[model samples]
Target: MKIPSIVFALLFTSFSYSQNISGKAYYESKTTVDMDNFGRRDMTEDMKKQIKERMKSFLEKTYILTFNGNESIYSEDEKLEAGDNGRGFGMMMSSFSAGDQYKNLETNQLIEEREFFGKQFLVKDTITNLRWEVGKESKQIGQYLVIKATAYKQVDPNDVSMMRRRRDRDNEEKNEAEKKEDTTKVEDPFEDLEIPKEVLVTAWFTPQIPVKNGPGEYAGLPGLILELNVDRTTILCSKIIINPKEAEAIQPPSKGEEVSREEYNKIVKEKTDEMRENFRNGGGRRGGGGRRFGG
Candidate 1:
């Protein structure tokens, strides 16, 4: 008679979790600005430095997570009243920003508001619950004990959307041409272009929180997620406010063109392609795009 490895591991991690835990979790999210990824080859050294400065305002950001039981709303805490983190030029910088996301584990639903080219989209779809491989290893995050979990997420390898990176005008025009396919044939509305996907996600959750929720699209753990590391971006929880005096109403975003995730992605692709066309033909400065939220 012998105890299996999995059973022993589970028994070792069976710490007494907390009870009646509910509250707000403050997470600080930071992203790196990859200059080469922005597709600016002809940019001078001075120009590159300037672009980094402007993008810095967005790369380092703060987000708030409000959760009670298995429901949560994750959104950016832009400190709008403070005004662009005192970066006066942020108002004139880029026009598009990511939207807030809300998820409900009880209903298996998700409602996210994504902003693209100044247009808002209500992305209504069921939550993509990732299959996580839990490990026996454990570590202490603050007062709670957390175990490791790993998952793989399919992502566009050439996706420059994160942090709203720049795309070259010529490349976009070339892509559009490729869509035309046969030169002698009529243009095709769609192309069979295949996008590569590559991304690995690592998350650590604390059983003490005891909720299957986390920041952004991450959830489905036996506990609360305290840290999420995806690619070059890091979203870490800095503080947990349990049972706040007042809780904000947790509701899905109602405004914007109601559409599914796939539909919204299509809309974004079309709008972005059009923007590149204008830029290639020297249509002047872009007019659309603004902060995701304004205080």
Candidate 2:
């Protein structure tokens, strides 16, 4: 008995749809700390470890993307936990795409445009406040197309309390005659306060996928972003599932502060500087103890 041409075509389509490709995304990124204008401070072994851990945390945070004619969903899960207790901080981000059941529920949503990295680009209105910028180049990730993008991290220079600490120290140096007897030190409440300059990042995206989205505040690519690099850290797409055997179910996250990509960078820089200050002042326990303990 011969099958009808329509029936054969249906079977072929089903077979093609059933095929699921899986693989791991390997990323090698360089990280540098701007210590002085002369050059960048190389990342120490401990610093590298910390960066990897941070990337692991970022991946643990979820971001979503959608494509046209695809009812499927894509996501990544960071397999690492918080803290520095061994277990190696690593991540595995995956994507799922398939039938209408798996399609994005908000595909009709409008794409919003904002200025990022000195360029006009598109992003989702839900996350319009986040800063984004264009990158300098492009590359391929598996079968998907990818382009590079950049974003800035800003720093706030007006943290008054930190400045007060500096004034307290200056007052200690004044001679008795130079210092007014009745005058209380009016501390300049902005010393010791540092704001990080805007940092540039490069990311890889594929415009054909039709989603201007990525992890953290980085977005506004012509296509779905597959990989990104900011400063020295990186985030990459590991696996994608288009048309899973099971029903596709994806729930986009609504938690997290919505800041422009620039604002986001500023926050990170401020916190990082604060932490480094704490470490330098011997206020917090240093990681690895700088080789004193054979770390």
Runs in model 2 deviating more than 4 A are 1-136, 151-195, 245-247, 252-295
List candidate 1 segments past 4 Å from native: 1-20, 35-49, 79-93, 156-160, 163-196, 283-295
Choose the strongest candidate by TM-score: 1
- Which stretch of 10 consecutive residues in model 1 shows the poorest summed lDDT? 186-195
How far off is residue 240 in model 1, in Å? 0.4
- lDDT per residue as tens, model 2, 26-135: 33323333222111134466765555455454333433333233222333333334444331112111110111112232352322232222223333333322355544
Q: lDDT values of the candidates?
A: 0.67, 0.39
- Note the residue pairs that clash in candidate 1: 95-289, 95-290
* C-alpha root-mean-square deviation, candidate 1: 8.1
Provide the TM-score for each candidate, comma-separated.
0.71, 0.39
Best by lDDT: 1
Cα TM-score of candidate 2: 0.39
